[model samples]
Target: MPNARISLPKAKLSAVLGHLAKIPASLSMTTIQTSPDGLWLYQSGHGLDVQLCFPEARTESRVTTSVNTAALAQMVSVAPGEAVEVEVGPSGLKFGTGGYRASLNGLIVDYDEPPIEAEGGVVVPIAELGRAIRCVRHAVGGVNRPHFRGVQLEFSPGNLRAVASDGYRLARYDLGVDGPLNGKAMLPLKPLDAALGILSTQDGAATLQLHGGRLAVIGEAVRLALTPMGQGLPNVENAIPKSYVAEAIVDPRALIQAIRRVSLLSPQDNRRIDLSFSEQRLEVRGAGDYGEGRDEVPLDTYRGEPLALSLNAVYLYDALSCIEGMARIKISDPRSPIAVEALEDARYLGVIAPILNP
Candidate 1:
């Protein structure tokens, strides 16, 4: 029996497991392997594959094994000590530190060597990528809405853009950073969300690589291999109305506060909010079986025709959440969807479809 052993500081090991926590529970097997470069932990789920590497723990020989994910995570998180020890067993893996040791049962699965890097992959700016994903993820569709359940990444040199939609609402974030990727790729929502979280805890840049024709984001210790989701999210640029007859600028924070204040009396089922925009002012009204509530916010730079539009209050709240400073709303007509953008930053854009007021 070739037992593989690895040792690392407690915090490092805990950090690795913490990132793994973001992965969906379905892929419940952990694959441990040793390479000339270092020690690797791999798991796959939600049409995505995640791999973490510890380059400092290079061993002399090659060893690979798969164990139950939950068991491993539990043993590591609850185990005591400042140094972590791992050893492979015939059908399981052992974890120990100082005076504590535990053995976890393994799973009957095979993990062939997966490519961690390609010949020519791009290094993605972690801060930019994380922020971009956050800006657009809210608009991503739910499980039932499979067609729009992923994000489209328009990656090219000197520019990176991410767009997501759920048919009713669309969000886009354009980053003015440079990368070597030149084409577009669609990534499943869960994996992207996990990757975003994992990256938040990490520092430095991550790589955008193609492993067996699948796109992946490889961080210093974390690798998110995204299995592209469905196709044809609504065109973000085309979806934004080219011109609007009415526009209004309002402080997003204040508007959100006003919406929430009036929403206290709104009906739970629909929580409908009626928005009436006109010269230098905007009126927000929320109504339900409890009765109706109205709040007015003075608009800045209001122009063009007066517009009365009905929208779902919850959806409107989400639309405003991403906007920092002031929001400039491009209101075309009562029936047309409104375009919202940040006045201080042009990188983000959002569109919300109106619902029937009555």
Candidate 2:
């Protein structure tokens, strides 16, 4: 029942508070739970729970009160390099540095401990996990369909896979790890996005705990938990053809630039772009009311017969942007799904369904 005071570097406090500010506004509780060790702020709603703990803060006594996440972040953001002193009293929480001080009233709410279980999870490099998330996040669909709004994570003894799809396109990223893991889970897009933001501020490693119907990501100063989608993800492996009749190898950067140039002429409503590839050149064409545009990019290698396919410009661009060095566009036919693989890294793959009518 005594006032609790804590002190931390302004930049550190600001960084942690920035993550807390990302929590959905729909979540009710906005309280800060403090103990002798550090301060905690948590919020849960829409099947996702996020908590940020400042374990490095120097604390005295104990307190439980809620403060405005935005206000706290703003206060610290302006404080810059100074050390911030946070004192929790009956009236509210006070934030101060060398010359500036401000107070905000705290909200009273019953705080329940967040269900975060980090046991039996694999320790993965933060950079690797972040890369995997970015590779597939764009493919995740909107909230209208709950099942397609998440990324599927498949784990084996030495392999970890992340897959996401929006019915039209799918992304799969495989990572090798030395750990004991054998299961599959779906991680909602919102929490996954939030986890990525938190992970960006951290270095070294992060623990991924998946058990029951929940997935918890434990980072340096942040912890995120979310309920996995109940419905099963589509069998993505089957969607990718075992072999291709034609393969066109092109520089990823050139392909990306060509797509962007042609897409400028594509209509806003029907943004379809045609990719015609033969032995020497890969031509990208787009037509609309605004007229048409075309760009021919030289290919490194082209195998099999000529192939022409129409696809959503955005979808193709998204797939191409994720690839690093060279990209191979493998096609069985114009009607069948087209496969995109990164030449530098075989672990990342993308599939986009062609616009059959176009």
RMSD of each: 2.9, 2.3
In model 2, residue pairs whose N, Cα or C atoms come closer than 3 Å (at least 3 residues apart or on different chains), thus clashing, are 31-66
| Model 2 residue 248 lDDT score | 87
- Candidate 2: regions farther than 4 A off: 25-28, 80-82, 108-115
lDDT of 1 by residue, 1-358 (tens): 3676878676766766666666786657778887677888887777767777788778865777787666666678787877778776546778877788788877645557566564466776788888888888889898899988888888777877889988888899988767666777888777777767667767788877655657878777777777786575756677778778988999888889889988888878777788999898899998888888899998888988888998878778888898878999888888888988999899998998888645
TM-score of each model, paired residue for residue: 0.87, 0.91
lDDT of 2 by residue, 1-358 (tens): 7788887777766776776677676644456778665777676666767776778764766667766778778877887356888787655788776777788787765556755768778888889988997998878887777779889888888888899998889998988875677778887776667667766777777788776677777877667787787875878778887878999889989988998999999978758998898999999999999899999999999999988989999988899888888898899999999999898799899999998772
Q: Residue 261 in model 2: shift from native, Å?
A: 1.0
**Model 2 per-residue lDDT at 53:** 76
User: Which ten contiguous residues of candidate 1 have the minimum total lDDT?
Assistant: 110-119
Per-model clash counts, in order, read 0, 1
lDDT of each: 0.79, 0.80
